[model samples]
Target: MECIKCKKEIPDESVFCMYCGKKQAPAVHGVKKRGNGQGTVYKMPSGTWAAEITLGYYMQDGKRKRKKSRKYGFRTKKEAVEYIATLKQSPKKEKFITMFQLWELFQTKKETLSKSKRTAYNIAWKKIHAEIEYRQIDELTVPELQAITDKYGTSYYTKRDIKNLLSHLYQIAIRDDYTDKNRAQFIQLPELQSQEREVMTKQEIELLWNDYQKEPSAITAQMLTMLYTGIRPGELLTIKVENINLDEQYMIGGIKTTKGKNRKIIIPDKIKPLLSWLMETGKKGLIAYYPSDVEFYDAWKQKRSQLNIRDVITPYCCRHTYITRLTTLKVSPAMLQELAGHEDYDTTLEYTHLSIAERLQEVNRLD
Candidate 1:
């Protein structure tokens, strides 16, 4: 048998066009034809019934393109018929919207989100937007979304954020009749691992110091600042020229929890000169003008490669190094918590990566 719409050949016993998902009518059964645009219903090979209706039409490539709505798995043809009747009573408006288009619409309606949350969602969007931005939401498949989820291999937080943002977008798509389901909701993220946090080695720190003294550019200055101040990469971007008080040897910057936000970060004498140089050469605006943490991370990655550093040190590792150094210096736990902008001392301890030798020395201190 040939499909009635796409004219594709199929099994003779087929009650629906497998190619087009259109309901098929047998000539012998002589299914009664409804009005011009009333749609159709028929029993399927699975003994269930399916119904489909033409919601609207548009011109594409100089041809009239029809938009359709389909419902399947009805127990009986009468059930399918009733479903179509209800759809005719109040037709659902189909939107030929792309993911990016839906994202724009979603943002306009999401006015209550905090600045941090809004930034998070925007960053997540930037990560995977290029993959499916222009594709129509309805055409997206679960495997496609899962592939995107799997691409970011241990970036558990980023994967979660992307999944969260995509889920929200899919919700909006469903509400607007752009798509029937949220494929993102079905995508799974990698299990979170509790790997030991890494810190910059003494050699890497010396290398950075040497490089800064030799040819100090914006990148080296940024790294030195984070290493000394223990400010998060996200917080590092929030620093402004106005926030620095060089004479007072402190700056105000942070983000995330209340304890972390806009906290006073004391600038070490070692890093003060670098900050002064950066502020002098930097524009009269933000200290580091890379818009997002992702871009800053890219700069960090390139700088590491150029410096020929083999260790997988990250900007956050700089913070860990700072905390470890402070702990080694016997800085009081209260002061350490304050400087790290950690809500609790335990959290501050988590960021401190003491080496085995250092731990042994601490143990020997009991003697």
Candidate 2:
């Protein structure tokens, strides 16, 4: 065929005449040839329209190369055209990378997390990558994100971690303008089961105390402190040698939130000797001393496993047992609340549990 403008012979398959840059009529086969810098639009196998454009390329030895970029899953051909138009307007788009690569970049740029927390995030990251590493982070939809989370939502802790990690990733994405909204934000974690905490029995407590007396470590001191003081495990991490007053035989503030629980708690004669021995260790800070103060619970957990007591109670149950013992002794409710470091009087009430034997003993005493 001849180009009408240039009077030059054009290839039968060409949509635009190469010599004159004029649009040619469609060949008998109805196929059109695409030109340079002009993008291609096609229907994907998944029944969605897609568009691609040749963006400027990286410079090599001496050759000009074209880099073709694609945007996927547009519902309509018009949408694909608009997408290409948007790409054309952009001076340069961020190079397309897998979600896992973005995560690696994210790790490098973000501030550090605590050691254990970093370990947990790494675990979560590996699990997430195994599921969706091949997928592009920028193009992820809400349903796609929800599906990923829902698949691993069986474990409560894991679900929380996945949501947190996803939010972090999307926050980075939004900051970099890779995405407009954090699709992970709308993913709700499944409701956790309300498993009741089991408090230590008198026999179990005796066993633990005897073990502590037999083989003492920082872990032993932390557990015994929780049992005696009813301090939250976290609050115990903040205990300093200065917080203990041997002269007054009381402890000062370690409670979080407010300074109200900073009152002098009369040190029981029972645990005072142990506290004195620990104080004699002369640790500058944190009486419940571990090399890593933040990992108190982990050390305590490892110690508990080593001891292998018959009934395994959580560290929080130490607070429960303390409150129960105080109730058994008929201590003042207001005083008990203060001792337990409870913010509410009602919260203190929930900790007190009277056994059948104790109730019967009380009834007999009433007669």
Candidate 3:
């Protein structure tokens, strides 16, 4: 069979057009939809990659020129490839909108949120706006935007937040004739997250500990702190030297939520060597002292690959490992909540992904 939009040959069993991404006409049944036109992924004049698809031709000065519709602002070749593939599968809207215009409409249409939520939404969009300002709604894909944090090397939690924001925007986009479906739903987070690496093996723990010893760098310090304390790396970066209470044997900083703020956690003896090394360095700012977010992530990914553990775990997974260890020690839920700086008890439950042995042991105590 041939795909109607691209005139490309397709297998008899194919459900969607490979070159165009539009749904195929069913042999007997199962045709969901078809793409409006075939799109080509190419380099834009801005030196960025884009998918150039016709938005329908327009006549000007008695001459008809193809009205080009494009999606822009991808940061890498791999992203551009995957993105244009998705655009081919979905049909573009007849009435088009630029991402900048859509963002404005979103701001006006959004209902009120809590102060913290409002602040969070504002902060997230600042990054989103920078990337999407020049692009069009036609080009954005859920997987591409979900990886936005990873592309820029921001935290996984921030990636989750970005995914949420994109999902919300796609909803509005679908409603306003910006696109056909919410691509955000199809996006899987980074490997460690999507795989749900909730706990680290003792071998993995030992590797992380030894790896930090070898480098004794700021990024390693943050990693060790998170492994021992269950603090998010983003929160760990905000901690100043003054927050280190050596006399009290704890640190005081965590700013994600109301309860998380000023959350003092006792420094584990295991992580103190890292803290001591950081203190000796005479650095006056963030402990994880990369010049920018990109460098921080770059350093981490490089080190992870060097450690030969990059495939299975990530720095954020250390926070989950900490929670799992505490749960093994039979830490009470309320105290765990306070120690973990979680605002809601329910949020704490997500971290309590316990093991079979742990569950069996706890259950046997009753008998």
Candidate 4:
């Protein structure tokens, strides 16, 4: 054979001229070449096969760049060919890593996390998982995540949890090259709303005692138990009858955090009769068995309305009243912190909702 352009001698089986690099007029037999950008399958030095495909293109450095993906370690050329064929037929898909996937990764890497903290993360993820669990974390913007957090979050604590979850997921995504930036870092959580803490007034406490004396029902007992013991409304519902120690004057029940979990709550002399009555009535089951927190709260609301108590007095105010009483009695800060199951002394102080008049009375005593 002769080179078509240069008229130089070349091998007869050549597909292109050796000297001029021009295509021969007659095509080669029994050999096929993939078209440009269609992708390629070839044998490797290790005797495995590889397949590659052009995914898309982008402009970089003032030049057009072709983005391609490759897969190696195929044992046979046929497997490589089939794989590349599937890639060519399907629409090009980006490497999408969902927020839920990142969550799984985060959980796997965080082995030393406390059980309570892990539970908190599970709860926080559940709030927004349905909306963005399947969406790629890299595609999510700060505003989008913020909107999701705002929509699903019910309280300052819940919103904080959602923000913390997002921040953690973004951390994993950035570390693994899924994304270069953590958009969660840019998200701003709204400040916690400051409201005047309300506790049951002395008059209100007299009213509850009078009302309970009149009725003497289990519901009345339930309210008085929380009022005297400072048991959280949620914790009150979760208490088992067996956990109540009438002779010992304490019960083992709390939840939500390390400091708050399984802590002993003292059964005050004021509420001991109420607790005993509740134990006998509930009969070894949950002391206050309303299926959910909402139901229990609704019952509390009904009880309040029936008793004609102040509208501002929520169930939480019962716990507040207990703490305020302890503070007024000059309980040491250390004892208050332990009794209230507060991790911080400051948190125990926050629970004491002393009236301005009471504060002024103490201030005047100093003079």
Q: Per-candidate TM vs. native? A: 0.68, 0.64, 0.50, 0.56
Cα RMSDs of all predictions?
12.7, 12.5, 19.4, 12.7
Ranking by TM-score: 1, 2, 4, 3
Compare the candidates by TM-score and give the number of the best one.
1
Show where candidate 2 strays beyond 4 Å: 1-123, 126-135, 139-154, 259-266, 280-284, 289-295, 310-312, 363-367
Question: Residue 86: error of model 2 in Å?
Answer: 17
Q: What's the TM for model 3?
A: 0.50
Ranking by lDDT: 1, 4, 2, 3
Between prediction 3 and prediction 4, which has the larger lDDT? 4
lDDT of candidate 3 at residue 313, scale 0 to 100: 69
- Winning candidate number (lDDT): 1
In model 3, state the lDDT of residue 99: 58
Cα lDDT of model 3 overall?
0.69
Q: Which lDDT value does model 2 have at 362?
A: 90
Model 2 TM-score? 0.64
Query: Candidate 2 vs candidate 4: which has greater TM-score?
Result: 2
lDDT tens readout by residue for model 2, 159-197: 788888888887776777666778888987878888766
lDDT, candidate 1, residue 242?
92
